[model samples]
Target: SFHHYETPEDIRSKTMEWIEDFHADTERNATLWTMEKLSKHDGSDPENYPAHVCVMEFVVQVGADTRTFPSWKGHCVTRRNLVHFRGLSIDKNDIRWNEDGFRPLPDLACCLEKEKEYLLQNLETLLHRGGRIVARLKEHLEDQDQSRYTLP
Candidate 1:
């Protein structure tokens, strides 16, 4: 039983809903760890500075029993808690694809290029602001004068 839509808007909305549901399902099975939340000394404590990050592993699986791909051998931090780092390879494969068979080269390339452009455009601000943020954290730690405050 098929009900054809009369308008593109109806079709678009239905498609969007379907895609949203699909993503929801995928996220249910995926593991997500936030470093800022995970790295805190106490469960209630907040992170004073950004963590030196790295990707421990990445693997693509289908359902519980099927292993679609092996875990990515190399370690690289593709993203931070908020900001994304570029040129990190998640796997040996050149590209990853979705269930709909859409290869992510174009999208990844676009995202990487946009990220690079953003970094280039804001390099001075990023460096200076980042330095200032670090300096402020250092000053706070120094004012406290606690050996425990220092990051290992």
Candidate 2:
């Protein structure tokens, strides 16, 4: 599934192998993917609603169970060898709320890889938007500074 930028075939294949190995590990199932990272916020919108979809990953988890329901630990990476971003927190309690844990490695690997593909495809667009946001934020701060009275 080639997309906007061409990754060398060796890199792609090697990356998948590493992902599969990590997934199959009994002690660690580390995956990297992009999602509409969100956090519960008590903002003007709502007291306990997920915040907006920024390009940044909030270490948020999203999954579904094949038996009863599923759960996940989340991490995001945008490229072949680099971790995209790391957040301040994770679901620290190991929330497997389905009465039993049921995560098949192959399926989980596919799910993670798919999300990674989606992120890779849109990476350019997202980066442009982020740049625009930064420019706008700088302007906003400057405006606020001008409005404040300076002590002589």
Candidate 3:
């Protein structure tokens, strides 16, 4: 249902653009606006339903332990069926549509979390601040062969 609104390539392009914009600006984080239809996929009156557009904000920051992390956090404020707008924090990872008595959409929350991870991977390449030590360690490990075969 969600793919009907935004394709995977669309998501990737938008995410990459955001990262690039943030890197160039260096003053403000990148903001992305995406809309996903909160439907049960019953295929009834899909066009008549209005989806609550979500606004997500992201920033790349280094932790105290010197690990790079993407601080991608935002809330989904959705107006249900032309009514008043209601919201749930994406940071919570458990979205409960209590206003309309709709059950929690774990998939939606999971998708949002996955976007954050994707942004982190993008940041690793853009910022190159994930940690030199870790990168070196990974390189060292990869350089060594782990084959269990014994040569004659």
Candidate 4:
């Protein structure tokens, strides 16, 4: 979406040209557009029905450059966790958004709460398993004669 600033036409054109040039080196098809047709909602669709994002991967060619991104998820970080903890491939600065800034999803609290409870519930088992493994390692180390080990 282009911003509707009440600026002169020439200025706007130059600004847009500059912006496009700045992003010219970036990969093509890096931006995802909303496609309503041949979507996931239909029963005949092989992909998940009523999917918000396209799970399918696609390639787009722009001049001599070729770029690829998933149907819906594309290169943008849409989730709350992704906004904060972008995976290895994503750069925070490159996140796509039409707004002045990005905001994490509003439902992140519930997800965080569930994650906290899950961690709490599994903490004991994890600790117990760690303790057993450490004890076994210590026992094995004790049984081995240190002098018999050779350094590389």
TM-scores, each model vs. reference: 0.19, 0.24, 0.21, 0.17
Candidate 1 residues lying further than 4 Å off, grouped into runs, are 1-7, 27-104, 108-152
Against the reference, the lDDT scores of all candidates come to: 0.26, 0.27, 0.29, 0.28
Q: Roughly what TM-score does model 4 have, to 2 decimal places?
A: 0.17
Instruction: Give candidate 3's error at residue 51 in angstroms.
Output: 19
Q: Pick by lDDT: which candidate is best?
A: 3
What is the clash count for each candidate, in the order shown? 0, 2, 0, 1
Better of 3 and 4 by lDDT: 3
Candidate 4 error regions (>4 Å): 1-5, 27-102, 105-152
Task: List candidate 2 stretches off by more than 4 Å.
Answer: 1-3, 30-152
Q: Of the pair 1 and 3, which is ahead by TM-score?
A: 3
Q: Which number leads on TM-score? A: 2
The predictions' CA RMSDs to the true structure, in order, are 19.5, 19.4, 19.4, 25.5
* Worst window of 10 by summed lDDT in candidate 4: 131-140
lDDT of 2: 0.27
Candidate 3 lDDT at 64 equals 26
